[model samples]
Target chain A: MIEALKQRLSEHFQLTNLTIKNAGLAFLWVEKHELEMLLRQLRDFEGYTHLSFIIASDHIEKNQFKLTYMLHNYDTKHDLGVHVDISRVNASMHSIHPLWAQAWTYQRELKEMYGIDFPESPRVDEDFCLEGWDDMPPMRRDFDTVKYCEEHFDDRDGRATEENRQTMKVNIYPERGE
Target chain B: MNLTHDFSPTPEVDLASGKYVKIWHGPQHPGITGNMSLELTLCGDEIVNCKTHVGYLHRGFEKLMERRTYIQNFPLVCRIAVPEPTFNEYLYSAGIEDLAGIEVPELAKWLRCLNLELMRLGSFLMWLGGASGAFGMSTVYQWTVTHRDYILDLFEEMTGARIYHMYISPGGVRAPLPDGFKDRCLMVMKKVEKLLYEVETTVLNNAVFKKRAIGLGVISSDMVDAYGVTGPNQRAAGYARDTRKDSPYLVYEQLDFDVITATGSDAFDRTIVRYQEMHQCVSLIRQMLDRMPTDGAFHTPTPNVLHWKIPAGETYVKAECTRGEYGYYIETDGSEYVRRVHIRGPSYTHAIAVMEKLVIGANIADVAGLMVSLHTYPPEIER
Candidate 1:
């Protein structure tokens, strides 16, 4: 299947760069990165019609975020999981929604969740969450969810106690710890 | 090049003239069975182009699963596919059990099958309603909804919650066979089977339904394979791809039933296939209740869900949901929290790829009709 897919990728797609890095029976992850020229060539390309998912993973350990486009060429039974690694500090990439309309939502979702900006995408400004007063984008590598929970969410450690509740009263209440 | 759909490119390439108005149908539309939208570019009553936009319903379930412990996600997993929640909890517990090397007792497996099949019937009844409503048959909607509420009541009696019954846990069920629960479930299921037959007379065999659904969303066998369509949608296209039949996790292998398949791969075929499968579910439920095993554990032993370390490994569990193959691909890094939980559902492919291919060249009037005919649960898609 890998050989067939690799041959089909060369025959069907004029890629600026492509490589097969991982292979396993459970799953195979083929890394492919394309420049602007190959991006236009891929538009007219057939067999790569179905798009499974587009995800931007915040690899905190690697200190870089990876944006992956999992495209399925149903015609050839070939799955090309294209990934582009970018620095966490400037997590931005060229959007592919111009080639496929379905990327519009997934790109918008990646931006909303990870604070990654899409430079050349359409409709990326759609609001998924963080309606106003923005803090760190939630899916960022440095978002610190536990800290965010402590600050934004209710830290109900011994929260249901009567004295703690009484001291927590808004008006005419004395400070106390339970 | 891959247009096995057999529709030739328009001789005059209407070219999706910019005059066509693009209408975003949902993410919220009453006509839509769930919170998903189709970007429909329509030229009068004809559809020139169509695209599906989901992810509005994303609850960050995979991300949220990373935060919560396995047990806490039971209540949350119920929200994955609200119409059918038991399967989500069932698969989660099953996956965890498989990882921990905990084998569910034979009785528990059969009981799980009983619950899954009954839920299938209940959920399919809901689908029958929405599928018919797509063609302006409001009565089927009312009929199926009224019938399904009784099943929910049975669920409430068996477990505590009406909708989100987090009854099935990692270690057997949350509670053992409630007194007379089996009889109550059987009675409701028998009544449901009767209502299902009435649905057959009024909706399934109804001529208007045929006109609305038949050949409306004709997905080819090749399209089904290419797009990874599974469950009823795949079966509807004459592919016998039910996980319950193929993998037979739980008690499905023990139970005796034939996999239902439809010939046309069209909207009508999908509806009829689900209708027939509901009958089979009724039979399977009866078989399970008839051979009631009142003696073994319903769940495996589980530790404190929070701070409970799960054994490091990956487990993938799939079941024949009312829609299609409902699966969860989970990865555990030996932590209490999941490393990654890829929630795969039937709607992921059905509402996205298959619908995208089917909607184009179909009449604009038939767009919503085609969607409801597919019977995709939107929350599952977002998950």
Candidate 2:
């Protein structure tokens, strides 16, 4: 099934970075310029109709964010993940909500969490999953959760803090000195 | 893509001669399921527009999981979906197992199936109570909740907890089944089946329920595809899409059962589909108990929970959960901690996008009932 999909996809579009990572699973690094065309062909021609999900992973080391669009083709019973890397400085991508209405929620979430801009998407600017949030995007790699919790919320009197966990780990495993 | 749904936002129209009354439906109301609010624009008794507001129960599970190790996240994952927690555990474990190349024992697979079917039965019982109770049928609600407690008793015996049973671990189940567990499970199934019959006769067959629910909240077939609605809600609309049958996972491939569906495509039909689905779960559990091996290892050994590291890879595992297609997208960076974990719950779509679209033309009184029919778990949507 993976080979058949690869063949079908290669026949019409370029397969520059296609890799079959696992059986019944394939990964393709889609270029930012060809995202719209690739998604349209996948939905229209390749029969991958179900837009399972769209998620963004922060890759701070690589200085880029990886956005994976997970899709499943009911006809072929195959799962595919289309990965696209966008710059962290000015994250922007075209909206595919026109292709699938469910994409509205995903794009809205991405906009809120990663500060990614989707040009021309309807209602993508509206707040989702967060209300009155004005800090850094909480899902980003740089958002320090421990510090945020410490500053914004009160701490219990008897609970362990970050320093306490580190001290306990060092005490338990003395051979691996910190 | 279908390309039939209007993706554009609803235009600002002058209703009530530019005097439309806007009201908040929930956040604290008996009609609501959880901590979520719906902004409803009402002109007289008709609803003009509805906007769903979530995040009341959001804990940022995705962000939190990235900071914790694989095992530390196990107990936290189940909290994503409070009503049906095992499905989250199953999907998370399945994804980690796939990424780490952990081979599960056959006995473990069968045990997982048994636990999964039990979770489905328990969740549907809760749904039965809520769906009928939305229409003021408190008798059905009380009976189903009382029976659901029996299933919770079975869970407590197995996992030492009732709501969040952290029994489903990475390589397999956390513990072996206790002695006489099968007999107790079978006895409970018999009781649940009898109670289900009474529920059908009293609530489902009543003429008043039919009058209120049969034609209300009808999900058109085209809308199911356009909005990505799944689980019993989509099946109630005559769509034969199910992850268990389509993409067979766990021991579901070896089980024998039919995907229950209905043609009415409305609240009543969706309720009936869930009703029949509970019966199907009973039969599946019976088959699993009869065929499961009597003596074998229930779990595969793994590394220490605090320091285990998975290779660098990404995998997406999905399960046909009680509510819908529950998917977990996992990415590891060859470290003791996870790089990212994205949870795609069906309620994220059904509760927000689809509910907003369906509630526009519905009557004000039917809004809560319609939301109930969709089986939207608020925590799943926010998390």
Candidate 3:
């Protein structure tokens, strides 16, 4: 079922790196400019009406952020994930709020967590979850969470930290050691 | 049926003119299911604009999962949604299994299904209590919560914990069903079935519940896809889009049950849909108990935990959570730790965008009932 859809979609649009994970799931890469039109076609014409989720994975080594828009076709019970790679420097992508009202929330979250810009999304600038989060976008691969915790918070006195549980257990009970 | 109120422009309220008052609805209120607030702009007891506020319970489980190994993340995922933790445990394990190419055993499959069905029954009972309590029926709250405790007792026997049962591990389940557990489970099912009847008589048939819930928070069928609504919320809106029926996972394909739905698309309709699903849960449990394979291996062995490295791949695994379509999108990097893990809870949209739109033009008193009727958990949204 997904093979025929991919064949029909590749005929018109430029689809690259198609990965058929299973019979009911597939992911394909498309240009950022082609995402909106492709999603609109899928939602309206291809029976992929439900926008399951939109998530971003930061590929810092490649200086790119991969944004996946998971679309579900209720009629066929298949999931088609549309992946779009945008540059990591001043990342921005075309917003799909016009296609799905819930896209704005995902866009807003991507903006706050990964510092990706979605221009003209409703309330995109406002805080979604992290209020008064003045530091770096916490989700970026560059942000070191452990360092931030050590710098901002105080550790409790007499707190024991163990790096390895097996070694600590052996040290505590040498008679019962294996 | 007229949904013009949802699309109509919001009337601006000027606080300087003293015509409207702004209030925070929750974070520490009994009406809210968890620790989250709604910033409401009200004009004489009618809410004009509603903006949902979360992050009070945001522990950044997604970011935390990046540093933890595959086995370490098993316990952490259950904390994402307090009410329904088995969905997280199952989906997390299922996503890992999908990417790692690990097929679970037959007996494990039926056990996982039984665990999930029990979780659904327990979570829905809690929600039923909250929904009734929001509507000023405290008696139903007491009755349902006590019965919910009966379900919790079953969880305690099965998984050794009441709330966060990290029993559904990656390769397979943690253990087999205990001895003599079948008859004990059937006993609790009988008690819960009796409780549902009492609830139906006292809460569903009550005048106050119908008066407050029938026409409140109507979600048009058109909004189900656009706003990403699912589970009972979308089912109540006249669409029978259930993950269990559409894409059957685990033992759902073997189970015989119909997708429950309602046509009104209102609070009362959603309650009826879920209430019927509880009876469906009872039947599903009975079917699994009768059909499950006896005396077989319950778990599949995996690689060593500390040095395990999954081959690089990505997969999104979802399940029919009591709330809606709960999922986990996992991307592996062929290393000891995961690259990216995004937990998609149904409340992420139902609480924010849909709640913001539904609460507009609603009375102040019905806001809690409206929110509860949507059946959202706040930790899942912020996570």
| Estimated TM-score for each candidate | 0.75, 0.96, 0.96
What DockQ do you compute for every candidate structure?
Answer: 0.08, 0.56, 0.52
Give the lowest summed-lDDT range of ten residues in model 2 chain B: B1-10
Query: In candidate 1, what are the lDDT values of residues B192-229, reduced to their tens digit?
Result: 87888788888877888777788898877667644656
Q: Write the per-residue lDDT of candidate 1 for residues A1-178, one digit (tens) a residue.
A: 5666446656644444444522311222332344333434432453555445567666677887766555544344344555567778767777765455445556776787787888666557766433452787776646677687678787667765444233334333333222
Best by lDDT: 3
Can you write out model 2's per-residue Cα lDDT over B1-383, one digit (the tens) per residue? 36556866576867557668789999887678877889999887788898888888989998889888787798899999888999999999999999999999999899898999999999999988988888878778889999899999999988889999999899999887899999999999999999989998988898988888988878887777567788999899987888999988788889898888999999999999999999999999999999998879989998765568899988888989877889998899999888999888888899888888878878888887888999888898777
Identify the runs in model 3 with alpha carbons over 4 angstroms from their true place. Answer: A164-178, B1-9
At residue B341, give the lDDT of candidate 2.
Answer: 93
Ten-residue stretch with the least lDDT total in model 3 chain B: B1-10
Q: In order, how many clashes per candidate? A: 8, 0, 0
What i-RMS does each candidate reach, in Å?
9.3, 2.8, 4.9
Fraction of native Cα contacts reproduced by each candidate: 0.00, 0.58, 0.61
**How would you encode candidate 2's per-residue C-alpha lDDT over A42-150 as one tens digit per residue?**
8888888878889999998898999998887878778889989999988999888778888888888898999998977777888888888898988999999889888
Best by DockQ: 2
Docking category of candidate 2: medium
